[model samples]
Target: MKIEEVRQHVTTPLTAPAFAPVVPRFTDREYLNIVYRTDADALRAVVPEPLQVEEPLVRFEVMKMGDVSGYGPYTESGQAIEVSFDGERGEYLHAMYLDNFPATASGREVSAYPKTAGSPKLYVDNGVLVGTLDYGTLRVATATMGYKHHALDVREAERQITVPTFMLKTIPGYDGAPRVQELVRTEITDVVVKEAYTAPARLQLFQHVLAPLADLPVLEVVSASHIRTDLTLAPVKPVFDYLKGVRS
Candidate 1:
């Protein structure tokens, strides 16, 4: 293949290309997000500088992507902390565990999402919305919420999901040092909220070596919601380059 042809390929033999090449869209995405308040000091310890933690809050999400445009169907579970970047309120994605390999590769390479191989299941059981995440044989997180207790405003739901999301992207250099280290920002646009509901919820994060979600420790369950939506992920843009001190 010519150099131009090689550059056009989205997926390499072993690595996935950047975000712009592969556009992923999701339809009828079922999400169950559990919001919790934790210790303020603990949150400040992990959240990076330049991103301010206004409240000690975290959103644990369990989602089932039914129809993905480019990648196939997959289930995902992750944790995002409420933070502010340059006076703009947003969420910083801490970690994600997914079952599909292609989605994992693209999510990490393209968007700098901290994705790893794991099993995440989100389903309804006997009228209860249930979500679970397991790393290998150990269960890391489990959440349950009442199914559709009350309706939620579609516009407010859209705003919650469409806000800017921050990520710490890193690539190793040839000498094993940091090559590309920057703060990536991304958001979902053209969101069509089909249905939204809220109900009482509970979350538990177990302590494990691989997925140490308990490090954050859920202090109180603030709220829970189930949302069905369709949206296209906007292209990733770097907001801060840690090594170069450049802003995009």
Candidate 2:
């Protein structure tokens, strides 16, 4: 392709890109979020600067995406630390693991999601909502909750979904140096909460070298929410630059 055509491309592999540039809209997106308290020092070690841990809280989430604009359907599970940036409460996404390749590729390449390939499943099993994540043949995380035991306020569930999200986006230079290092922020929008509920939940994290979610160590289960919504994933904008020490 010509240089002009190359400039128009949004991602690599001009012949057949891994994912399209369409903004993904998730329909019937189901989420099981378990917020728990962890060690304060563990939170500090993983959460980067400019984001402060207020109460040593972490949210473990399992998302079952029904229909997506570009990615079709996939199940994703990850952990986010409850943090504050600029005095505003938000979540700093630590890692995301999913089963879809295109979604994983596009999420990491075009957006700030720390995406990786893994086996994650979310389903109802024997009258309980279960979410599990496995790296290779080893189980990394498992969460179980009562299936929609009590109704939750739609506005509160919306707030949980719309909370500002922060992530560190890093790109390495060709010469083995830092090229792009940014703290990006984004939030979900245009949400239509179909249903939401609260339930008793329990989580277990196993040790794995690559997926070290157990490092946080769940101390106490603060709360849990099961929300089903139709929403859009908003684009990310760099709020702070680690290399330059200012907004990029």
**Using TM-score as the measure, which candidate wins?**
2
Could you give candidate 1's per-residue lDDT for residues 1-248 as a string of tens digits? Answer: 67887776766662444333557789999899999999899889989878999999999999899889767688999999999998999999998999887788888877788999889999999889999999999899999999988998998788778889999999999999999999999999989999999999999999998787888999999988899999998878989998988776
Taking every candidate in turn, the Cα RMSD to the unseen true structure, in Å, is 2.1, 0.8
Tens digits of per-residue lDDT for model 2, 1-248: 79999998888788898898899899999999999999999999999998988899999999999999988989999999999998989999999999999999888888889999889999999879999999999999999999989999999999998999999999999998989999999999999999999999999999999999999999999999999999998899999999989866
Q: Give the clash count for each candidate.
A: 0, 0
Inter-residue clash pairs, candidate 1:
none
What lDDT score belongs to each candidate, Candidate 1 first? 0.89, 0.94
Cα-based TM-score, every candidate: 0.95, 0.98
Candidate 1 Cα errors over 4 Å, as ranges:
14-21
TM-score, prediction 1: 0.95
Clashing pairs in 2: none
lDDT for model 1, please: 0.89
